[model samples]
Target: MLLRAALAALRRVEPVIVLEQLGSTFFDTALQMVVRDRCANATDPGRSREDSQQKAMTDFFMTYNLILRLTPILPSLLLARLSDRGWRRAPVVSSLCGYLLSRLGLLLVVVFSLPLQLMLGAAALFGLSGGYSAFWSGVMTLVALRSSAGDRAKAMMRVELLYGLAGLVGSLVSGHLFQLYTASLGHGTILLIVGTLLNLLCLILAIVLLQVKHVSSEEPEEKSLLPPTSSNATAVEASVSTNLVNIVLLFVAAFLYDFAVGGAIGMLGPFTLKAPLSWSPTQVGYGNAAGCMIFLTSYIGVILFRRCISDEAMILIGMLSFASGIYLMAFATTTYIFYIARILNLFALIPLPTIRSLLSQQVQPSSCGTALTLLQLTLKFAGLAYIPAFTKLYQNTLDWFPGFIFLLSSIFTVLGMIPISILGWRSAGGKCHVRTQGGKQPRCHLEEVPAGTSQTGTET
Candidate 1:
C-alpha cells in the first residue's frame, strides 16, 4: 500500500515544479555572478570600470533576454497545440530538454572558461525547445484540467507557492555551493554542475513519471445573464461576446503588469551590485530568498482573500501593493530600505497567477493550453519591449537617477490595474456565491437578478 501510494503520488507535477525551480534558481545566480565577473575582468583602466562593467552587463543581458523571449514563440505555440490535443506532456518534456541543454551549456562554459558570448547560442537552443512559455502553459494546463474552475486560482497559486519554496531553498544553499571548489575545479563550477544535474532529473521525470489530467468533455456552463426566453441563443451570444472581451482585457492587463515587473526585475540584477548595496554571493542569495518569500505571502493572501472577494479584487490589491512598494523601491539606496520595499510588496505575485486563472476560465478545456501559452507568449513580447527599452533607459539614467526605471514600473503597474477594474465592473452584475457545488473556492462571476428576485449573497 505504501509503495502504491508513493507511485500514485509520483503522478503529481509538484516534484517537477520544485526541481526545475530549484535548478533554475541556482543557474540564475551562477550566471549573474559569472557575467559580472567576466565584465569586471575585461574592463580597461581608461574609463570608469564600474560604468564599463555595468554597461557590459546590461548589454549582454539585453541581447540574451531578447533571444530568450523572441525565439520561443513559434515553438511554444506548436507545443501548446500538441498539449491541447492530449499530448499534454509535449511542452513539459520538450522544455525540460531545453533546460537540461542550457544548463549543460553553462556548465561547460564555466568549466572550460569559454567566452560569455557563447551563452547566446545556448539561449537560442533553449528558446527553440519551447522555453518557459511552453513549460508554464503545459503545467498550468495539467493543473487546470484536474481542478474545477472555482478552485483554479487557488490551484495555480499553489503551484507557484511550490515554485517559490523550491527557489528559496535553492537560493539559500546556492551561495555556499558556489563558493566550494577543489584543486581542479573553479568557483561556481560545482553549482552549475548541480544545476545541470537537477535539470536532467527533471527531464527524466517529465518523460517517465508525470501524469496528464484530462478535463471534462462537457462544455463550461457560462451562466445565463438574461431572463429565460423561448431559447437561450441570445444569452449564448452575449456570453460569447462578453468572454471575448474579457479575454482580450485580461491579456492587456497581464501584458501591462508584466511590463511593469520586467522593468524593475531587469534592472535589479545589476542594481544590487551597484554602489550602496554591493552584496556578496551569500547576500545576493539572501536577497533572492527574500523575493521568493513574497510567493508564500501571496499564496496566503489568496487563501484569505479568495474567500471573501472576487479574483479581480485580489488582483487589484496585489497591483496596489506592488505599485506602492516599487515606488518606494525608487529610493532604495540602503539594504534595509530595499527589504522594506520588498516587505511592502508581499502580495505582488498574486496578480499574474490570478490573471492566468482568469484566462484559463475564459477558454474551453481543450484550448486551455493554447490560451495559457498565448498569455505566456504575450508576456514574452512584453519582455521584448522592456529588454531593449528599459535597458537603454536605465543605462541613460544611471548617472542622473538610477531608479528612474522603477518609477516607470510603478506607473505601468497603475495602468495595468485599469483593465482588472474594468473586468470587476463587467462581472459585478448580481450577487455571487462564496461556495460552489462540492464546497470549492469562489468564482468571480455574476448573473442578472430579475426585478422580482431577491439576491442574498455578495459578489465573489
Candidate 2:
C-alpha cells in the first residue's frame, strides 16, 4: 500500500517537476537571447524603451530559476526540523493543503495573464517541490523509526526501488509529453496547466492516504530509535558525537561522490538534446528507460550478494562502477557506447540504498533523519555548484570538456574507494559494533562491526 501510494503520487507530480525544470531552462535561455538583442539595440536612443522591456524579461527569467532552485531546499530543511519531533498526521495534512492551494493558484494564474502566469508558476514550483521533499522525507523517516532493525534495510531498499522507478518512468513520459505538446501549444503554458492539475490530484490522494491508522498516529509505547533529549548537556554531547572525525570523513567522501554523480546526471538530458551527435527526445527517453531497467536488475543483484559481500565492499565496487560508467559516457562517440554507459551508471547506483542503510545503523535512530538530511543537503548543494560549471564548460569546449569533467569526477570516485576500504576493514575487525550479544555469532548479518568482534557477550 505504501508503494502504491508512492507510485500514484509520483505519477501525478513527476511530470510537473520535469516540465518545471525544462521550462525554467528554456526561459533562461530565451531571456539571455533577449538581453543580447537589447544590448545590440541599446546604441540607439530611440531603442531605450525596448532595451528596458527586454531587461525586465531577462531579470524575471534569472530570478525565476534562482527561486526555483532555492525553493526545494526549504522544504527539505523543514522536513529535517520536523523529523526531530515525533511523527504525526497533522503535518502531512498541512503540507497536502499547501500543495493544493499552490496548484489552484497556479491554475488561476494560467487562466489570467502572462505576467501572473510567470509569477504564479514560479511560486507553484517552489511550493510543490518543497512540499514533496518534506512529505517524502518525513514519510521515510517515520517508516524507519517504526520498522525493526532487521526490516529497516529491506524497507529502505523498497523505497529506493520505488523512487528509481518513478524517476525513470517520469523522465521518459514527461520528455515525450513535452515534445508532443510543444508542437501544438506553447510548451511553457501547456506544461503549467498539466502540471498544476496533476499536483492537485496528488494532493487529494495524499489527504486520503493520511487517514490510514499507521500514518495517523504513533503506535502505543513505540520505542523510538531517536536518541533521548533529556538534558541540554546530553543533547550537546550527542550532537558532538555525531560530528566525529570518522563521520566527517565519511560525509566528505559522500559529498564529493554525490557532487560528481549529481553533475553528470543533471547534465545528461541537456547533453542528449544538444549533442553534436543527434538524438530525438524519444530516443533519449528510451536511453533513460534502459538505465532504469539496468538499475532494477542491479538492485536485485545487490540483494542476492548481501550475504556474500560486506556493505563496505559493495560501496567500493559501486564507486568504481560509477566512475567508470561516467567516464565511458563522457567519451562515448557512438550511441551504443552511450547506452552502455547509461546501463553501467544505473548499476553503479544500486549500492546507494545499501550505503544509506549502513549509515542509519551507525547513528542513533532519532538522528537518522538529520544525518540523511545532511547528506542530501550536500548533494543538493553540489548539484547547484557544479551545474553552472558544467554549463560553462559545455559552452566553451562542448563534448571535449565533458570528458575532462568525468576524469575529475573519477578522481573523487577513487578517493571514495579509500574510505570504503578503511571502513570495511574496521567493520570486519569488529570496531563499530551496534548489536546486543547473543549465544552465538549472528549469521547472514552484514552490519558494521570491528574485526574479531563477537556479539555473543556484548550489550547493544
Candidate 3:
C-alpha cells in the first residue's frame, strides 16, 4: 500500500507544474532587472536616460519575444504530431529540455557578466525546443485525454490552481532572492542558480518518472451525450463540416483575445518601471504575485460558473472581466489603483482553459492533442503581430499616453467576444447528435430528414 501510494503520487503532474512555474517566476524577475540594468548602462549621454532605458527595454523584448514565438512554430507542430502518434510526452519532455538550457544560459549571463544580447539566442533555443507553446499544449492534452469531456474545464482549472499557487510563492520570494548575493556571487546570480537548479530538478523528474500512459477520454458515455442520430455518411459529413466551422470560429476568438491580452501584457513589465510607479524589485514581485492571484480566482470562477452556465457563457464572462479591468488599467498611475484593476481582471484566465475544454469536446480523443496544439500555435501567430506592434505603440506613446496600449487591449478583448457569441448562437439553434456506436467527433452532426419531411420531422 505504501509503495502504491508513492507511485500514485509520482503519477501526478502537480509537482512538475509547481516547479516549472516557480522557476519561471524567479527567471522573470531576474531577467527584468538585468535587462533594465544593461539598458540603463548603455544609455547615451545625449538621450534621456529614462526614455532611452524604456525604449531599449521594449525594443529588446520586442525582438526577443518575436524570436521566441517564431522558432516554436515548426518545432511545436512536429512535437504535436508526435504527441498525436502516441509519443505523449514528446512535447513536455522536449520543452523541459529547452527550459533547462535557457535557464542555464541566463545563469551564465548573470554570473559571468556576459552581454545581454546572448539572451536572444537563449530565447531562440527555448523556442526551437517547443517553448511554452508546446509545453502548455502538452499539459492540456494530458489533462484533456485523461479527464471526461464534461470535467475538462474543472480539470484544467485545478492545474491552473496548482500553477498559480506555485507562481505566487515564487513571485513573493523572488525579489528578496534576487537581492541576495555574496561577494563571490553577484546580484541575481544566486537567484538564477536557484531557478536553474529547480528547472534541472523538474527536467530530471519529467524524464525519469513522469507517466505517459493515460486513459483516453473516449468512454461510451461521451459519445452518447447527444441523442442517437442517423448513421448516414452524409449526416456524418455534415456534422464534420459544421464542427470544422465552429472550430475555426473558436480559433478566431482565441486569437483575438490572446492578441489583446498578449500585446498589452508585453508592455506591462516596462510600464511599471516608468514615472510614478517606478517600482523597486520588491514591488515588481508583489505586482507579479498579484497577477498570479487571478489563477486561483479564475479556478473558483470556473467551478462556480460551470454549475450555473454553459462554457461559452463562462468564456464571455471572463472576457468581460478582463476588458473592464484592462480598460481601467489605462487610468492607473498609482499602485493601489493598479491592484484594483488587477482584481477586476480576476476571471481573465477562465477563457482559454474553457476554450481548450470546448475545443476538446469538438473532436475525438485521438486528435485532441493536435487540436490543442493548433490552438496554441494560432495564438503564437497572433503574438507575432501583437508583440512588436504593442511595443512600438508603447514606445511612441510613452510621453503622451503610455496606457494607450492597455485601452487597445480592452478593445480587442471586446471584439473577441463576438466570435464566441456567434458560436453560442449557432449552437443553440443547431440540431446536434453524437454517434453512439461508431466513435466519431461531436462537433458536427445533423438529424436525417425523410424525403418529404421537414427538419421538424413533419411532412413538407
Better of 1 and 3 by TM-score: 1
Enumerate clash totals for all models, in the order shown.
Answer: 1, 10, 2
Better of 2 and 3 by lDDT: 3
Query: Residues 1-460, candidate 1, lDDT per residue (tens digit)?
Result: 9999998887789999999999999999999899989998547455467877888899999999999999999999999989878799999999999999999888989899998898999999999999998899899989988887667788999999999999999989888888999999999999998898899888888899899765563433332223323265865676567767878889999999999998798888799898878888888888889889999999999999987887889999999999998999889999999999999899999999998888876666778889899999999999999889999999888777989999999999999999998887776653442335576777664333211112333422
Residue-by-residue lDDT tens digits, candidate 2, 216-306: 2232221222232335576456434543534655666676777677656645644554445445645655666665565565677567655
* Model 3 ranges off by over 4 Å: 44-47, 216-227, 431-460
Score candidate 2 by lDDT.
Answer: 0.53
User: Alpha carbon lDDT of residue 87, candidate 2?
Assistant: 47
Q: Rate the local accuracy (lDDT) of all candidates.
A: 0.85, 0.53, 0.86
Model 3 CA lDDT for position 46: 52
lDDT of 3 by residue, 196-299 (tens): 99999988888887886566543443241232354677756766676677788899999999999999888999999988799999999999999999999999
Name the regions of candidate 2 deviating beyond 4 angstroms: 1-75, 88-136, 179-195, 211-246, 399-402, 431-460
What is the Å distance of residue 50 in model 1 from its true position? Answer: 0.4
Could you tell me the lDDT of residue 197 within candidate 2? 60
How high is the lDDT of residue 115 in model 2? Answer: 39
Indicate the TM-score of model 3.
0.91
